[model samples]
Structures are given as structure tokens and as C-alpha cells.
Target: MSKHLFSASLLLAISLVVGKSAWGDDNAQSPEPMPPQLEATIKAFEAIGGMHEYRECYGFPSLKFHFFGLKLDSTDADIKKMPVVPFPFAFTSISNSITDLGVAELAKQKNMRALNLVDAQISGQGLAELTHVKDLEVLNLSNSSIQDKGLEALSNFPQLRALRLGNTEVTDDCFVYVSRLKDLEALDLRFTQVQGKKLNELKPCEKLQQLLFSGCPVTDERLQELGKREALEGLDLDYTQVTDNGTKTLENFPNLRNLSLSATKIADQGLEDVGKQKRLQRLYLSGTRVTDEGMSHLGGLDQLEELALSETKVQDAGLAKLSDLKNLNNLKLIRTQVTGTGFDAFSDVPLQTLNLSHAPISDSGMKAIAQIKTLKELTLDHVPLSDEGAKQLASLDNLTLLSLGHSNIGEEGLKSVSQMSKLRVLDLSDTPVSDDSIKELAKLKELRLLYLSGSVITKDSIAQLKKALPNCDIQSDSK
Candidate 1:
């Protein structure tokens, strides 16, 4: 059987074992018997390669179940021989191949609290069948054929807490029904026709916290209506028309913690307003006009943890200003002008992960990075590091994952890399290292994964290295 089918069958067997034990105990209080409608629904779902899991609730025999409708090559006759499931599902996901008949069977699951129908063929009329699921709190119909009339079916789910309609045909007219969901907390309308003009319709949802409008035509004027939502915490405006003026309205959301302005017209002036968000934890400014000057504004965001500055003009001087962000741990400077001169500034920042792929890092920069003792993962793909520069990485005693692909590191560098006894994953693809360096790589007794694609190592050398490190998953061009 295929891997998907094998996994589903194993889970079903385990669930049956647990169910038999629970039901066979006369002294144990068993869950209420399954209704006939639910039994038929489970059988119908199983015919379409569906899998269900049951778990005991609060130390009691009463169990709650989750259903998954996976697309597999199993035939209806094969599924008919499987054992029956005797529990109600609280979560159901019917993606890619669900039909109207399948959805009609799903409506009988009154205990469903979350449903995902992404990329399904069901229409608005099919969605109306789910109105009986009063306890449904989360619904995802992204990449579906659901339109404005189909969204009207959501009026029956006033207690819904989250809804995602990305890449759908729904327009601004759908918000008329969406605005009535007063208990809604999160909404995703990415890549849809619903512009921000009608976003004010969501004012009744005072508990709204997260809103994603990425790949939409949201303008600065329409964005202002969201300024009054002080309860808002996360917002994504990637690929929108909003500029620096649009970001000025962000200060009204004092509780905002995560923000993404990638691929937008936001410039250095916008970072000035973004710096005002003292509680901001994650920020993405990739593909923007932010330069070295804008880095000064981010110094006050002491709570910042993750920041992405890829594909921008940020250089060494820009990184020096971020030295005071002690809480910052993850940073990406891919395709930037950084040469590693300011890496010493992060010595006291406790950074654990850093990516500098495609950057012009020099030998001195590699030497400076060696001082960061807390670094556990590092990437330097497409860098012009010399053999001596690659050797400097040996000082990172805690390094577990390292990538030096497409660099000039030779056999001498691989010798130093072998000294990292704690290294778990190593990538030397597209480098100048040859068969002579295979002995050095074999010394990594703890290495679990190794990649040497596009290297000059011969097939004989790879076979010998594989024999030496039998536990390692070595991937070389010769293989």
C-alpha cells in the first residue's frame, strides 16, 4: 500500500484497539452511542479515503474525534471491509476532491467545531448544507468557487471566530454578511476582489484581532478605517498599494505585535512609524526601500524577536543599530550588501539563527561572526568565502546546522568542519571540495544529514564515506 494509505490504516487500527478496550469494560463509563446518521456519514466518508482519530477527553472514556478526507487510490470495495468508527468528529477537513454528496453527508456532523474545504469543488449551495453545524467556530474556503451569495450562508454561523476566503470570487458584497459575525476574531481575504473600502463594515466585530489582506488593492485611505481597532494584534499588507502614509495609522494599534510590509512602497519614513510599536515581536521589510538610515528607528523596539531585511539596501552600518535589541533571535539578511563588518554588534544579543545567503561577506566578516557563541544555525550560500574564512566557523562550538554551498571552500576548510563534533546537518554542495575531503567528512559521527551535490567527489569515495558513517543520510552527486 502507499504511504498515505498505510498511515491511515495504522491509525484506524490503533483507534479500534482503544475503542474496543473502552467499550468492553463493564465498570468504565462509556461514551453515548453513535447516532445512525453519524454512522452512515462515517461510512460514506471512508469510501472516499477518509481517516478518523479518536482521543479520550479529561481522563474519561468519552472520546472526541478528528476526520481527514485525503485523496488516495483506494477503491470503494476496499473501504467497505474496514471496521466502523463509533465516535463523533469535532474537526473535519475535506480538501481537493469533495463533492456535493460528500458535503451533504458532512452536514450530519453536528459536533464539528472546525472545517477546512480549501480547493474543494463545492459551491455556495453546498455550503448552505453546513448551516446546521451551530458550534462551528473556524471555516476555511480558500481557493474555492464560493462567491458573495455563498458567503451569505455564513450568517447562520454568528458565533464563528475565524474565516478564510482567500483566492475566492467573493467581493465587497460578501462583507455585508461577514460584518454580522460579531464574534469573529480572525479573517483572511488575500488575493480576492474585496478591497479595503468596506473594511469599516467589520467595526461591529470589536473582538477582531488578526486581518490578512495580502495581494489585495488596499489603499492608504481605506486603511485608515482600521485605526480605531485597538484590539488588533496582527496585520499583513504585503503587495498592497499602501505606502509610508498608510503606516502612520499603525500607531493607533498599540497592541499590534506582528506586521508584514514586504513588496510594498514602504520606505525609510515608514520605519519611523513602525518603531513606535514597542510591543512588536516580528517585522518583515524585505523588498522595500529601507536602507541604513531606517535601521536607527528600529533600535527602540527592544521586544523584537524576528526581522527580515532581505532584498534591500541594508549593509554593515545598518546592522550596528540593532545591537540593543536583546530579545532579537532570528534575522535574515539574504541578498543584502552586508560584508559582516558589524556582526560583532550581535555578540551580546543571544542570536541563535542567521541567514546571509548571496551576500558579499569577506574574510574579516567571517572572523567577526565567529564571536557569536550562541549561533546554532547559519547559512552562507553563494558567498565568496575563502578557505581561511570557512575555517573560522570551527569556533562555533554549538553549531548544529551549517550551509556553505556554492562557495570557494576547499579541502582545507572541510578539515576544520570535521572538528564540529555537535554538527547534525552539513551542506557543501557546489563547492571546490573533492574526494580528498571525504575522510574529513567521515569524522562527523553525529552528522545525520549531509549534502554534497555538484561537488567533485567520485562515486568510489562516496561509497567509502557511506560505509564509514552508516547512520548519516549522505546525498552526493555521485549517488
Candidate 2:
């Protein structure tokens, strides 16, 4: 019987025993009677492990006990002889040096569910032992020194759903063996030598939803094949040779929503196909050759919500097209060229994040952004925004994170931003703010992280500021 029902039976037995008076007088009241079935159930529990820990609940239709991490090797043969918590599910760790092959063997024998041999130093030989467990669902072999040989052994597991092979020496050929497991859903091939020839064999599993090919040789062409998978929802192809042609192939994937094409040759023409995919919600084209021309195509995508163009050739003109995408919520133009005209494009859209670092924006650009009352996060690092721009930004009551690092803002400009009570993370680095304005910052009790690097403020000033705001994490490179 379940442990919970067994515990309830034991409690009923104790109440029955306490109610009966062994030597009661003839006139004395009879003790409360107990159920005989409950007493018998207690005897059954005592026959087993003698109840180390047990609980019963009628509110929810489930029973659980804490026999995990308990030593099954006891001196008493009565308890020592029983099966070691058959199908150990919540068991935490098993040392390899102990040679407890019975642990994995028992799981297979009893139809156990989850097995985590992560960082256990298991190799091909150890993995071979697990293939017999056909019911295995989730297996984590991360940092276990599993090579391609070990991965080859996993092909036998027919029910494997999630597998982690991070930080292992497995190569691209490993995907060939991994692909054989048709039931596989989630896989991690991060930081492997899988590229070119190795990547050609990596195809979509029937149920695979999330796949991480970070630091691998997966180009845009491979991602194009992946995009066609009806089940694929998330794909990461960061730092690959895939170009706009590869992305065009992805238009075949009607279900694709999130795609990362960072550090590639994706330009405006590449985005033309991407813009046509109405299902695309988020696209990352950072560190590429995408310019304002690419923005023209992106403007046509109705479902486009988030776009990241960091470290690209995207200027203000490209961003103007985004005004047509009513669902566009976040836009990152960091280290790009977004001027006043581009900032005005967001006036109609409700954006939450706007990163324009290393741009050449003036006060006019800030005024244009001020029209976006939905803006919560704004970055103007290394830009030419002056005190007037700062004043315009201070007017946005929804502003939470503001970075004015290396900008031409003075003490007066910094003071203008002090009224933003909702500000959480502020970077005033390389500005002309002095110790006199530190007191004003203390009023922003919601501030969590504050950066004052390369500013005119002194070390003593930071120390005094810390004293006023003891709980805030202040980072200053002034020394």
C-alpha cells in the first residue's frame, strides 16, 4: 500500500490501543473502540522498513515520504533486506568510486523516471549501462567527460526527451548519433567542434523545441533547415557564417518566432525575407552589416515585436520604418547611428527598451524620444546629448533604467534626472557631475545599481555618497 495510507492506519491503531483499559472496573466506562483493519495495516508497515518517515493526506490525492539519502545497509536484516527504496527518484548523488551499479540497474528494473549523472565522470562505458532503461525521460550528462563514443551509446535510449552534453569533447559527428534518437526533444551542443561537415547531419527531431548551437559551426543554411521544422520555436545561431540567403530559406518555417543571426553578413536584403515571415516576433541581427535599408523590410512585418541591431550600420532612418509595426515593444540600436529623425519613428509605437549607445544624437533626438511615454529603459552612452536632452528625458515618468555614460551632461543635467523616482539602474559615467549633486541622488531610494566611472566626482565623494545610500551598489572608476 502507499506510505501515506500506511501512516494513517498506524495512527488509528495507536488511538485504539490507548482507548482500551486493560484493568478497568466493572462499573468503569468502556474505552473507545478501534478498527481492526487499521491495526492490521500497521502490522504490515512494521513488517517492512518499520516506518522511518510517513505522511497521509486526504485533501490532495497524493502520498510522499522522505526515505531518500537514508542508509539501506543496516545491521538489522529485517529492514536491510528490503529493496533500496525501489526506483529511487529523488535520490541526489551516487559516488562513482563506490561502484553502486545497482543504482542504475535498479532504476531500469523498477521503471524509474529521472536520472541525473551530471558531473559524475561517467564515460562511454557508464552510458552503455543506461541504454537498457527504455523508460528514461530526462538525462543530464553535462561535464561527465562523455565523448562521441558515449553519445553513440545513447542512441539506444528510445524514450530520451532532454539530454545535456555541455562542456564535453563531443564533435559535430555526435549529432549524427544523436539524430537517431527520434524521441529527443531538447538538446545542447554548446562549445563543441561541430561545424561544416558535422553540422550537415544535424536535423530536426520530431519533438525538438529548443536547441542551443552556440559556439558551434552552425551557419545560416543549417538554421534554414531548422526553421522549416513545424515544432521548432527557438533557435540560436550566434557567431556563424550564415548570411541573408540562409535567412531567406527560413521563410519556409511558418512557425519560427525567435531567431538570432549575430556576427554574420545579414544586410537589408536578408531582412527582406525575414520581414515577410508574419510569425517572427523577435530577431537579433547584431554585429552585422544590416543598415537602414534593412529597416524598410522589417517595417512591413506586422508581428515583429522585438529587434536588436546592436553594433550594426542601422541609423535613425532605418528605425523610422518600425512605426508601422504596432506590436514592436523593444528595440536595441546600441553602438549604431540613430539621430532625431529615427527617434521620432517610435513616437507611435509603445516601446519598453531603447538602447542607442555610441550614436550621435543631440537634444533634438531626445525630444523626439520623449514622445514615447512607454519607454522604460534608455541608454545614451558616448553620445552628444547635452543638458537639454537630459531635461527632456527627465520628463518621462515611466523611465526606469537610464544610462548617460560619456555624454556631455553636467551637474545641472544630472540634477534634472533626480526626480525620476522610478529609476532603478543609472549610469552617469564620464559626465561633469560633482560631489555637490550626490545628495540629490540619495533621494532616489529605488536606485539599485549606480555607476559614476570617469566622472569628475572624487573617491571621497563616493564614500560620502555611500554613507548616505548604504544599501545601494555603487560602482565608480574615478580613482
Candidate 3:
């Protein structure tokens, strides 16, 4: 079974513990945190409402910051204390705090690869000092005060690869500076005024792999030109007016791997063009006009691994049409009409992860789910899973995670769950598991983390359970 099964589960980790998240990577090499200084610095920045993503870059984890979340009043003097995050603590960002003086200070750092100042009130002339960071490779000036002059000054960084100018004031008249870049791979210009002939001026950018334009005035003609590019791998056209004409153009993209068409005008027929792409792996069609008939076109997508049909028209009958998708390991059916009575739709299917939270699967309907034997994780939040239906899950011995919170599971259900003993994470929060079932939970000494919030557990019961399962990180802190 795939390790991402619990990724869509309603169970959230307590975050205080250093264990596997109930809904994230289970095969953790090591669920380790950064060093004390690095963690403190990140927490300090996060305290000011900065959102960031960290990834391994050249042997060190680098951060990508979004400065739009910061208040407009944030000053260069206050933001100038940019942490000295070197390779091991590499700090990359879609936004950063830098001035002419700040950029001069970065010249000493040799390994800095990416710099950003998004939505910040920095002056356009401040970019003149950016030429000092000679080793920089990625730059993001999205939603900043930078204009044609500041945007063109970026051509000085010959090694720059990924650039984002989304929501910027830079116009089509100044695209030559961007199109001339020799090694640019990923370019994001979403919400910019780049449309019509404005996009064509950058036809020289052939090495582009990912082109993200969500709110730009993109059309099928631009998409058709993109389809002809052999190196383009990812495209995000969410919230755009691109219809089936634009989707059909991508049917023959040789290397397209990830496609996001969320909130678009694509109906059933637009997906027909998507099914023809054999190399596609991840497809996001959330918040669209696609129905069950549209899913029929996806039956031939044998190579697809992840599919998101949330808030679509895919019901039991429509979902049944996807049984032939044997390679499908991840599926998101949130806010749909899947009643959970059609286990046959998943029969013999290698479904490692499945989300049916927003559906109307009753306790009796959950009986149909017993057919999935290879399931390693199961999420039944907001369902009608009572003691009877919860006990039926003991048959799935491979379950490392079982989330039944916000349901009707009581003492008997906990007893039934305790018998399995193989579960590493259990979420009985928001249920009626009372002190009477404390002993039943205590039986599982191997449990890593348990959520008993909103349950009728008492301090005495928590003490007893703590004594019974000394290793478990019990979250009986709530009612």
C-alpha cells in the first residue's frame, strides 16, 4: 500500500510530538527538526505571519517565503534582520527583506541561490544593488514596486533559472528581458496583464518546463504553442478562461506530468483530451463542471496515480466506471455523492488512499468498505460509523491509521478497535468514547499518538491510560 493513504485523513497530528504525522509521510527517514538557532529564526519569522515552504537545496533545506502575508507597514529596517541562513539553513523565499544596504550585505554569502521581495514596499532603484549577489540563481519580484527598469535590471544574473513576476506592474512592452534568459525553466506570471501578443514576445523561452498563469488572460492559442514544447512538464491554468480548446491542445504534450485545471470551464469533453496523455501522473479537476460522464474519458488513464474530483458530479455509478484504473493509488472524493455503498467500485483496485469524508456514507454503508483489505489507512470522519460498523474494521489488519472521530463510535467501538492492536495512530476524538472504554484503548501499547478530544475521558482515566500505555502520546487534554 502507498504511504500517502492517510494524507487526506481528517486526523491532524498534535505537532508537539516528533513522530510520523497522521496524514503525512509514514516512511519518515527521520522526523527531525532543524537546529535550535534555525528553528528559532523560522518561528520568529512565522510569528509575524509569514508563510513558507522549506525543501532540500544543495544539501541544505531552503525556505520559500511569501511576503504578501506581511503587513504593508513592514519596514526595510525591521525586515533587514534576515537570518543568516547558509547552506545548512539555506533561506530561499518568494519574498525577503532587503535594501540597497541589505543586498550589499548578501554579497558575502557565496551559496545563496534564490531571493525574493514580493509585495514589499521596496523602491525600484533598490534593485541596482542586486548585482552584488553574483551567485544568485532564482529571483522573485512578484507584486513588488519593481517596474520595467527594475525588471530589466534582473538580466544581469545570467545563472538565474526560476523567476516569478506574477501580479506585477511590468507590462508586455518589457518582456524581452525575461524572454532572453537562456536557462529559465519555471516562470509564474499569474494575475499579470500578460495576454494576447504579450505572451508571444517571449517565444524564445524554449527551455521553460513549468508555466503557471492562473488569472492571466490566457487562451487556447498560447496553450497550443505550449503543447509543441517537448520540455514543458507542469502547467497551472486554474481560474483561467481556457476551455476545452485549450485542454485539447495539451493532449499530445510529450512530457506533461502535472496539470491543474481547477475552477475552469472544462466539462466532460475537455477531459477526453487529457486521457490521451500517457505520461500524465497528477491531475487536479476540483471545482469544475465535470460530471460522471467526464470521468468515463479517464478510464484509459492507466498511468495516473493521483486524481482529485472533489465537488464534482462523480457519484457511485460514475465512480464505478473508474474500477479499471488499476494503477490509481490516491483518490479525493470530498464533497461528492459517494454513499460508500459501492465497495465493488474499489474491488481488486490498488487503492492505498481514499477520502469519503464529505459523502453520506452511513454506518450500514460502511460495511461495504470492509472489502478493501490492502488499505493501510482509513478516514471515516463525518460518517455514521457506530460501534457495529467500527467493529467491522478489525478485519483490515494492515491499517496503521484509523480515524473515526466526529462519528457515533462509543465504548464498544473502542473495544473492537483495541482488538486490532496493529494500529499505530488512532483518532477517536469528537466521539463518545468514555472512561468506560479507557481500558480498551490501554490494550494497545504500540500506539504512538491518540486523539481523545471531545470525548468523555476524565483526568483519572487519562492517568490510567497513561500508566497502561506509557509510550503513547495521549491527547486527552480536552473534554
Best of the candidates, TM-score: 1
lDDT of 3 at 443: 85
Ranking by lDDT: 1, 3, 2
Please give the RMSD to the true structure for each candidate, in Å.
8.6, 15.9, 6.5
Choose 1 or 3, whichever is better by lDDT: 1
Model 2 clash number: 1
Estimated TM-score per prediction?
0.84, 0.71, 0.78
Q: Per-residue CA lDDT of candidate 3, range 1-479, in tens? A: 12222432324443221112112233223223444555665666676555443333211011121111112123454345444444432233333454555444445545556665566545545655556555566666677766665666666677667777778876665567787777777777778776634665667778777777878777777665443677777777877888987887785467877788878888898999888877776788888889878888888888877788878877777877788887877787777888776666788678776777667876656676777777777777766766777777777777777777677887777777887667877787777788888778888877877878778889898888888988877876643
**In candidate 2, which residue ranges exceed 4 Å CA deviation?**
1-122, 129-144, 155-159, 166-168, 196-204, 219-228, 453-460, 463-471, 476-479
- Model 3 scores what on Cα lDDT? 0.66
lDDT (CA) for every model shown?
A: 0.76, 0.63, 0.66
Q: What is the lDDT of residue 447 in candidate 1?
A: 83
- The alpha-carbon deviation from the true structure for residue 92 of candidate 2, after best TM-score superposition, in angstroms, is 10
Scored by lDDT, model 2 comes in at 0.63
User: What TM-score quantifies how close candidate 2 is to the native fold?
Assistant: 0.71
Per residue, candidate 1 scores C-alpha lDDT tens digits across 344-458 of 7887888888999899999899998899888888888889988889889899989877888887888888878899999877878888888899889999998877888888899
CA lDDT, candidate 2, residue 242 = 73
